[model samples]
Target: MATNLALDPSLIERAVEVSGEPSKKAAVTLALKEFIARREQRRIAELLGQLEWDESFDHKAERSRK
Candidate 1:
């Protein structure tokens, strides 16, 4: 899928410079991939943390019921 959207030229310039990708498309792709990976990592960490909390709660509840 392809979409067209306008962005601030200054931001695009900075991204292109830092990425050294020579093209706006390449810079945006790199940045978008990094952004998605970071979000996925955070999400996985959060889910694991929640699972740990749930297991701890289950153990506590079981002990109290005995």
Candidate 2:
């Protein structure tokens, strides 16, 4: 897909240096991918303390039983 948006020159240069992607396109692509992955991880982290755990469940013990 081809799309155009205004991007910061310095950020592009820094991404090129850090990612060592050899081209602006590659660097931009890698940066966007990493950015999305990091955002998803942060979203998942926000759910860390909201889940209920079962005190009676023993996953390791179940594995050992096998």
Off by over 4 Å in 1: 52-66
Q: Write the per-residue lDDT of candidate 2 for residues 1-66, one digit (tens) a residue.
A: 999979999999999999989999999999889999999999999999999999999999999894
Q: Which ten contiguous residues of candidate 2 have the minimum total lDDT?
A: 57-66
- Give the clash total for candidate 2: 0
Query: Using Cα atoms with residue i matched to residue i, what is each candidate's TM-score against the true structure?
Result: 0.67, 0.82
Clashes of each: 0, 0
Q: Which segments of candidate 2 are over 4 A away from where they belong?
A: 62-66
Assess each prediction's global lDDT (C-alpha) against the native.
0.89, 0.94
Give one digit per residue, the lDDT tens place, for model 1 in 1-66.
798888999999999999999899999999999999999999888887466344445666778894
Instruction: Score candidate 2 by TM-score against the native.
Output: 0.82
Q: Pull out the clashing pairs in model 1.
A: none
Q: lDDT for model 2, please.
A: 0.94
